[model samples]
Target: MSGETVITRFAPSPTGRLHLGHAASAIRAHDYARERGGRFVLRIEDIDGTRSRPEFVAGILEDLAWLGLRWDLLVFQSERLAKYQAALETLKARGLVYPCFCTRAEIAASASAPQGDAAPVYPGICRDLTVEEVTARAHLAHCWRLDMAKAVAITGALAWHDAIAGAVVADPLAQGDVVLARKDAPASYHLAVTLDDAAQGVTDVVRGVDLFAATDVHRVLQALLGLPVPSYHHHPLVVDAAGRRLAKRDGALSLAEMREGGEDGATLAARVRGGDRLATSW
Candidate 1:
């Protein structure tokens, strides 16, 4: 890690159009860095080749620029596959990665089940699977899962200095064995995010409060990979009239639709900030 001035990034996946929720994150990240006399970065998370679209990326850049949000450097994750692979290999060599052959149905048939709002906790059926057994059982190229036990042993407790929430700790047992690389996807969100954040030398991470739960997984991965954990600030999410989170799927609330409705950047920014106008300087 640089261990220097603060550096924050606004990373948006180009799978859908930017909405009010996205604007809140972008604005907050930009403001946080600027307030600290630090640098802000723009990263395009276009790893999902199937859903990611060039048009969406273009729109995101245009929207942020309209809001007067700027960054020091712009990056695309699609161009960093080799970096992810190298990290994956390092884990593999250390026996920190295991091949999981459990199909979705098989995982669901396990004795226990996932809790509310969380993806089914991986059963860890493959954690102890031997190298020969794992290779033999696999029909197709299987995914590589993190060895949580080994990881935790290597790094006792995963902790981070958060910006808003203060100190944070993660339990590897709760996170279980997270996927690192998949047959279909090169790198999972947990893997890609940790690697990218460390690589970019990010000092702070700002996002919606809804992601607070997942922060544990990110923290655990950072410790396992010997990466620096950035301070986090999970801000409140913007909601619609119905008190539901605004999302890209809701076309009417999307930035594109708002633009067509004659809402300028200043107006949209005001609406997001509780219908009150920001300083003209913002």
Candidate 2:
């Protein structure tokens, strides 16, 4: 993307309050673009209707603003369900995806092997169902799964670049037929994020290293949909006092709490930008 404006984004789910880890990530993404005279976008990954809250959304906006971070554009994945559904339909129409009627229990029970820390690799149990068979189970809840073998065959060998890891080969099959969408949740993260980055004209993706492997699946999705491939920079995740990654589910202290406790948002952001202390002193 030489000569192209560096476009980066910090897409976070509004399930909980932002923590220092989030601050570091947001600073990374924000600084990456601002340093390059580019633009930074703030995207809310709130497709999980069961967990997303408007209050959290408001809190995220407030926290970032308090950090002196300004976004050129704002995006919400919840608003683009139709676009994700259309893309999933495109894959289904092309025979690149199929309806999976298997429940979570059945999938876990049938997993041939685990793919690292990811959920059990789907065994494609419903991959061979006939059109009539699918129609027969019309009442059954189902999700869309990419036909990994077919998809990879159609796309051939694919690859992507990471600013930290450098050249990497695409390996979506390693993850099996990942869910693209479900009846209850029309847009899956893999599908929505891949589509959103391309649609938003993101040139340089900046995020935590936890999603490094997920990039492999995203690469295949990008190739299948013929989306422009953007450069990636997967930075190390922020750690807490325990030297373990902080998570909202783990009840990590939030930026809101820190700000209320008299911590300076801009000072913390500046420390993050300077790579000061993510482990003990933060």
Candidate 3:
């Protein structure tokens, strides 16, 4: 919309091989940048260190290369812990983020209703903890969750523009107090992505529609951190013949498997763009 040099990125977590769904998203981002003579970036979202394997990271790079996808810049989130920590501290100083020690079971038990497709909305269990109480739990394992209500009050009304969906208002409340830093990881996806997008100077974010809702939380983070908000374009997700969304755990046909079964990289990319359903066997 701004006619500025667009910067798009294909960020994938290296926990498994690239599947057809991943290919579609990558191709969309790459083409968006290429169409405008802009820069395309590749970011490895390996923040989940325990599950993020080096072999998977290597496989991701190889898969993208095989697909003829080129990136102007490459970054790994594992290497940017300090930056994320700094951003978290900035929020903490603003009294916008609080610690939450709730486990999965505890949260599910406390939630009043189902929270849109994902885990139930966090019910702000620890949002009003006293300083002494917070100090007492400092040594225990905990996560930093954004104080959604406080955040909204500070930022007031907010909105962002999307290419397909048009202008959208920010609704951080629906997401509840999203975790900024997890007990197991230095930063959560919402926090890392918002910071990384700003750090990379990305002008346009192109990805699947599944993440369209998550944009609300990201917008709040951008406003709280005083970071530039980028235009978003959430495309449709690739689904199997059964209409089930593709996922790594569902034994979806991976790019590596397709290549081994004699699929050409460029041809496969074209088929993906054309919305040709992939065979489960191949």
Candidate 4:
């Protein structure tokens, strides 16, 4: 990392408008890059065709620009679907990923421990499906999942560094055979973001702490795809009056509303970056 130009990114999904939580993440990454004479990339993670909207994308740009943050480069995950597919193909070639035939209801009902964003840790039901079993279910739609146990055996023990948590050992199994590809989407978030970070030469990953656990899965993907792993800095998420994490579903105030309401973007950004909860109050 010595003498290497620091590169950090604010990869936001365009499913909704940028909120104060989004601003905190952007400011953290923006300031981290700018303070060290490095490049800051603004990546739009809109791979989910169903939720992502052009209006939200436009609003994201407007909000960031209003914050006075200039990105050195811009990237859209939707445009890089081919690259992600190629990576998934590479993993497929290595026998790393497999097709999962389980449905949402079956998974939810069977899974005892859930890991991320309400997604239950997969119980590996389809992990050892026989060739005939696969053929039997061939007519059904399916998604791709990593063969976690085999992947770990091939990669051996894995580890990475975090700016906040210090040295960390990766435990990909904790998440269970995570998804690498979806039926509608060519690639999953774990696979796409990890490849993008390496492809863009990102040296530091600054995002909310909610994604900290996802990093374990990302690290494993990095090793499997032979991608460079970057440093991570997971900051606390912005919460509301009830102390719940700010979410678009929760009607967390959007930056667009703030801008229209005449709240100073710079002032709010600074307050959030300073760990001031009052910035989101009112």
Cα RMSDs, all models = 3.6, 1.7, 1.6, 1.6
Model 2, stretches more than 4 Å misplaced? 113-117, 278-282
The lDDT-based order of candidates, best leading, equals 3, 4, 2, 1
Task: Give the clashing residue pairs of candidate 1, or none.
Answer: none
TM-score, structure 1 vs. true: 0.89
Per-candidate TM equals 0.89, 0.94, 0.96, 0.96
For 1-282, candidate 3 gives per-residue lDDT tens digits of 566888999999988899988988999999999999999999999999788999999999989988889999999999899999999999999888999988999999887877665799888888899989999988989999999899999889989988999999978798889999999999999999999999998999999898998999999999888899999999988887667788766668889988999989998888777777655632
Q: What tens digits encode model 1's per-residue C-alpha lDDT throughout 73-101?
A: 89999999999999999898898888887
Higher-scoring candidate on lDDT, 1 or 2: 2
Please give, for residues 213-235, the per-residue lDDT of candidate 2 as tens digits. Answer: 89989999998898999999999
Predictions in order: lDDT: 0.80, 0.88, 0.90, 0.89
**Model 3, 66: alpha-carbon shift in Å?**
1.2
Cα-based lDDT at residue 125, candidate 3: 88
lDDT of 4 by residue, 162-184 (tens): 88899999988888999999987
* lDDT, residue 79, candidate 2: 87
Q: Report the alpha-carbon TM-score of model 3 versus the true structure.
A: 0.96
Residue 242, model 4: Cα distance from true site in angstroms: 1.5
